[model samples]
Target: MLSWVQKRGTSEHRTGLETPLQGPKQRCWFVWDPMGIIFAIATWALVLSGAWVLVRDLLIPSNNVFYAIANGVVFHLLASLALVSHLRTMLTDPGSVPLGNPPGPDTVSYCPFCLCAIPERVYHCTVCRRCIRKNDHHCPWVNNCVGEDNQKYFLLFTLYVGLMSTHVLLLLAIPVLRSHARGEWNASSTVSLPGPIFFLFLVALMGFIFALVMLCSQMCSIYKDKTTTEMLHQNKHSQGRQSMWANIKAICGPRVSLAWLSPFHSPDRYKVSERHVMA
Candidate 1:
């Protein structure tokens, strides 16, 4: 892929998006765009920076060994899960249709950009330069498109990030709240947050807000049997059966299990027999 990009050079207008694939490429799913790569790196940098500051300024300095150890363990665990989920979402194939695949039963129209016939709910991601099945949207944060194949990882990413952020915020806030309750803090008491702590607070707050909004949106999309792209385009015709639980199971897995919460687990594969077209 890198060699292919180098051959095309950067001066080309659309580069990857406009150029149709001449042949079937290997299954590596990384996006080669500069912006996406930078954003992905920044995401890791911020997560690591927050962890370092939290450990240095908040967790290690605590007087109680048990308190520090417990919080540190929980925070690191959640952080690890969030990062792993993000990596999985970024690297996993998001159900890309075969390049230049011949028209079939589900074919709606040919994508000029990808030179392939795409089915219902399929959309072309310019960044990824592929027609993704049930493409939701291209997220620079994860540096990939969210679609049928990897929505579970995207959801898990948001969930774990939200939990970790909330945990950090609560740890930073509770002491102040307790002090105010005990009358140790007053309007003129002039308690101020240190620079590093303030920076950590901002990071946690941003992560929490972003994760909460995204998680809620993804949940609603799943329940309605739609993608973010479908919602935005107002494509309301149902592509599959309308059972909420069934849709959830389809994205998360075949059955309810702890694996649903795991980034290591892949979602149940979508079988053609399980899908039907409306007449």
Candidate 2:
């Protein structure tokens, strides 16, 4: 395949990524990997189930209508943001280099598996079946590779999830604390929670911890201007990179603002070329 690609004339290579099958493929961003699909489904199931339990068991039954309305609104808003961020992360293309692309002046190597020229900071993801620019580790939870284009959405997903989890934990704890303070509740006064409420507590606790840890790791990576893959492999080439704020801007957007927090906004610093598929 390498030989065939190499033997092709410049004009053939110049045709770029366009081909008969490219259009349909470009329209779909879903990865077909079984484990990724399963994890994605599980993620949606967890979010939906937890939200239902929170609303039906915890929020609706509250004695204070104002409290119930306020908490419910906040929880749903955070949950909606988290879900939107997850969808954007999964559906956005992660800056995959055009397959079978011709080597350029800055090309550092070639990916034999992909039969494409590999540029600096590019790594091939076997699961993605392509070379991704600034490729980070693939995330099963989001069912996508965290790479150049989609990193912003992934960060926002973690942030909102962590915030939502914290909110849930507070809602569960405050009432119990208040009862105890008034001497109306004690260890002997404690009663078992309903099944759905119990389930919600467990989910919130687990989600909080997971999101907290992942968010911290991702923030550190952004600060250091190194991806998880580069750090793990000890890629020396990543040294002498831009400063922390510059690196953050590069990934999130050109300027630091509320837009950086939005999953609907694309980073202006790195636009995908026409030759690249948006899949």
Candidate 3:
């Protein structure tokens, strides 16, 4: 009876859907994540709306508004370009090169979730559930993984976006500040003067400023040929000593901008050679 019971239990476990067991490997090119998509859309919307307002106000021949708008648009465009470039690299790059023929030994290590072999300087993103080539941390706002391909673009995006947002805030503030100085409103004035719009503008300004500062700091580290992981490790060991500017210049090189835009350096291009890696 004990043997029968044991066999019954084994059979039941095998048939149970809740039981954890390894299944056949399934290959898929793209996996959709709705939350990620939504986040990306929202960020893009903010950028577009800000650009529209700046352009519209400038066209009205309102004091320095055009200059402010142009500055804001340029900055945001640069930043967005950087981020998009980085994200594109990550998505296209194959995780690893498969062993030819009989496949005796697995030459590369891979994360189970993403099913991609880890590349040199790459890391696994827990949130995105993928092994990114030259992986940087996942960016929540962009809803995309940052890796070797898109890193430069991502950096550009951060820098420009920050500059644009800050410029807009200042431009908007000048008129209000000037009016306030002239005692335009009473102390208890309840009159609506685009207050809600201004409040939203302030919120966006603050948010972008914080994001820009953080991204710029990270970009400085990356330019030094260091990952956030490596930076933290070095900091812990060396009491927060940062990499020198010379080191960063060496890694980034003189033609960094050209290299950044070239698709040859992109992770999506399977032909990426060691020459593409920064020193």
**Is 1 or 3 the stronger prediction by lDDT?**
1
lDDT of 2 by residue, 197-236 (tens): 8899999998899899989889888887778998999887
lDDT digits (tens) for residues 1-279 of candidate 1: 333333333334333232222235457789898999999998899899999999999988888899999999999999999999999999988878887664444455677787665556778999999888778899999999998888899999999999999999999999999989999876689878999999999999999999999999998898777888878888867566668888888888888999999998877775654533442
Best by TM-score, which number? 1
Candidate 1 Cα deviation (angstroms), residue 85: 0.4
- Evaluate all candidate structures by whole-model CA lDDT and list the values in order: 0.82, 0.79, 0.50
TM-scores for every predicted model: 0.89, 0.85, 0.58
lDDT of 2: 0.79
CA shift of 126, model 3, Å:
3.7
Superior by TM-score: candidate 1 or candidate 3? 1
- What's the CA error at residue 168 for candidate 2, in Å? 0.4
Candidate 1: global Cα-lDDT? 0.82
Task: List ranges where model 2 is wrong by over 4 Å.
Answer: 1-25, 185-191, 271-279
Cα lDDT, model 3, residue 86: 32
Which 10 consecutive positions of candidate 3 have the poorest summed lDDT? Answer: 98-107
State how far residue 211 of model 1 sits from its true place (Å): 0.4
